[model samples]
Target: MDKHHKINIEYAKKLGLKSALVYQYVKDMNSDTKLHTIIEEFPYLSNEDVGNSIKSLVEQGLIEFNDDNQIITLSSTIQKTKIRTPISNRSNKIDKSWSPSEDAVEVLQRAGVDAEFIDGLLDEFIIYWSERSSTLVSYNSKFIEYCRLKWAQHTAEIDTKSVPRIIDKNWAPSEDCLDIIKMTGIDDAFVRLHLPEFILYWKEDGRAFVSWDIKFLDFIKNKWNYNVEVTSKEHTYKFDLFDPYADDEDKSKKSTKGNIKDLRKKYKI
Candidate 1:
């Protein structure tokens, strides 16, 4: 099977899980299908979701719609047919000011990233790798993953304004809760099983109301200092795009797939 077709099928399934109408619209969309046609057909959808769904499909290379053409069409990837388009003259250019493509920007936006900081975040990622070595790896996928990290960092910095409402002002960890948790053993599963207890204890006594799941896990790891026997999964190294291909660079740095692996593991990407 074609790689692009496989990718579209996977992404379509993901979109389907969100909204069946959106999924069907994506699966059936072609150059002749107008945006208004979709809107009229799926009246239950908000214009924003419909628009977002379209953009997401485009970003994933399932579809394409240029502003000048105003025609929605299956992307070459989705169609499994090539349509010749003007190739960029600067495709081989080497410049310090290079930025991610529009597809990359759409991806960041879909991930709920703030637009203003995207360039800065990309620059930061590039500079981080540049300083370590001249070689770069996994330009598109890694950069997409980088955008996710930046979004996470950005959200974490800006604390949520919603006040933490106590579920029960007088709530205390019951003896049963403690006993069950203890019996569950000191592991991540134990913490997950008694998350309510952890939340109440943290809010009431620890004075920490963690909102992120990762942060909550870290808190449990630190507070309990318990070892969980988590089996480490094998990491598959893939490099689809690398700019200024580092053919002559030292193999050690140029082929340091571990750098990206370490990053993925650290951020749980």
Candidate 2:
């Protein structure tokens, strides 16, 4: 006698042929089977392909892994009738109140994603897809992909910021940072005027920071706001280069006053 495996054609179409094959194998075994044993059964497929198939099955809620991740079994949600029937292809626009399924959340949590982080992205994700004209058969799968991509990017940014280093003389604000500053209506010349001072101040302080771009942005915003406030208050004060009555202390403050004067004359801010 020979054993027969029932492969779900719909699953094969949705999740590659390999995934459907692996799901059927797990269904038939009905026992906690080692991952390596399954891989050995499929000699024609590469280990990477086999691994991806198993991951796909797990992500789709058709299969699950034991705590150790060495054993695989069918999920409790799996049904024999459901496997035999083709999945419905009826697609509709995502609802404004749509949320990811529990299975999707569990898969992400199993992959070590933080629950709080996942919650934080829900609104942005919902708004983004709700505005689109597209529809999906399985939002859970899409949400899983979205969450994984975002988590990867978030981790990359954290890794970049964690390693603190001294600011080099050659460093300057990135184009993206400059673009954001420009969008706020800050003058390019004003930014240039403060660039050297900003760099010198940090260099002299000898304090390493996670992000100089952020520090520069804060510095520029504060200085620009202060300049605007001072200019508005002293709209009538005129700086005289050679005032006989001007004291040395007042002359020392004249540099800042002069810059503001120049800013008013040039930008009319």
Candidate 3:
């Protein structure tokens, strides 16, 4: 394996996830591998085992899954990926910069005070401090709507965007609480019906929420040709917007598609 791959696998192992997850997520471009594909790629793990691992990593905040994109992805960017070089090659070493916080700790250390806490102060700690100080939060509604859709590119699991978050000090879901998703099935239904406008939003109080337009639900229900329920076995996500040109009655009253009516010389098809 290349040195980068070796580093990625080591990181993945630290989080109890498959090394392939690190490979897929750590590369520069966006990814589209679904959870099923991930499980399939790592043949040794069973579905249940993979599912458990997902729960664990999501809780750890090391990775998140875009249901719409179908990939387990890394969120932490602190660790640098190392590239391999020739055996005889020598490279200059980069030095870590000193910040005010580091300076304070160093002064304390010189005075014989405890400065060890600074060792745990990483760039991520600053992220936490910013969130806490400003009461800002990542409301899932935005992620569910944009990030998930762009990544998954599928309509069915697109509702996974609505999957309620366990955003907290520990991000894992409680057993019965998670089962609520499985038994209720309504959120999943809404995801399927109105995915075009699903949104994840954060409130002013540092809480995140997800929502979509209900009028869209009414519009689709009134316009849909078939008997479609959330769990309906015959449902499809295809919309009629892209069909061959058909004249609308109101528009045709003011205009015409055939040669005779008006302004034909001024227009081109």
Candidate 4:
């Protein structure tokens, strides 16, 4: 009926209403529950305004409650719905019961999240902004190191006792897997120990090979002027021991971001 009431009505629409609750409460000429309930839940309205609006709805016969019996009866069953009318023109055209969107329809069936929470996220303006905002693919130096270690462990899962013939085909390692190998810094013999006999023989069982094309090792070499060759390729064809990122150098050079901005934003979201 007025500006304040208009805002509350819109706000309340997001919160699902139980038809039985509204009808029973409205039936009572003097509701015992503090009028503060409407204001508190909405938080967008003052106590006086929310109380008076509920009173107005009662006066206008929009809601009807019998306080003594705790019975709620709506003047029109349609009047008690959370949605004022319909979400779209097509909805008005359908005489048959409407099915929610593929997503919206799930709420009536599932219990994972409250329907109101999902609805708010799907509001037109919110959806529009979300579509525009870019999502991040997170990466960390230590986490990358962990992945390489895990990859070594993962490959070890293959059995050494498989049908023993050198296969004609070899699968090129994934880029991430290769990066792990580069970062791992394990001795070639250690690398061989982790590999299945099949992988070793599929190439050449007699030789374990390591070659250094890694740029990071060179960066460490020049900056600290540690001429110590950390790069090693332990091969049956050739073998050498080197410390690419040796223990002697300062560990502080490893990049740890001054700020973890992405993690902070994700926490806020």
Number of the top lDDT candidate: 2
Compared with the true structure, what per-residue lDDT tens digits does model 1 show for residues 1-269?
01111224564467653344554564565335545445434534554565566666666665665433233566653333332221222232223665666666776677567678787676777676555533321144346555664455445445544344343444433332332223223433546555676566656674543234334444554555433222232132134346345654666675577788898999999
Candidate 4 structure quality by residue, lDDT tens digits, 166-195: 333343334444445444332234433434
lDDT: worst 10-residue window of model 1 = 84-93
Q: State the C-alpha lDDT per candidate.
A: 0.49, 0.69, 0.36, 0.34
| Candidate 3 C-alpha lDDT tens digits along 26-130 | 343354334544443343444445555665555556556554323455654322122111111232111133123333344334533333433444343444434
* lDDT value, candidate 3, whole model: 0.36
Best model per TM-score: 2
TM-score of 4: 0.17
RMSD of each: 20.8, 21.4, 23.7, 27.8
Summarize candidate 2's per-residue lDDT along 1-269 as a digit string, tens digits.
Answer: 01235788987898778888888788888887666556545544555566668767776777876533356778864333333211123445678787776767897898667999999989988888888976543355557656765665565458577777678887798664564455344767888899999989888999987667777877998998899887887745555436666687688798889999999999988
The TM-scores of all predictions, comma-separated, are 0.33, 0.33, 0.22, 0.17
Select the stronger candidate by lDDT from 1 and 4: 1
Model 3, residue 132: what's the lDDT?
49
Candidates ranked by TM-score: 2, 1, 3, 4
Clashes of each: 0, 0, 9, 12
Which scores better on lDDT, 3 or 4? 3
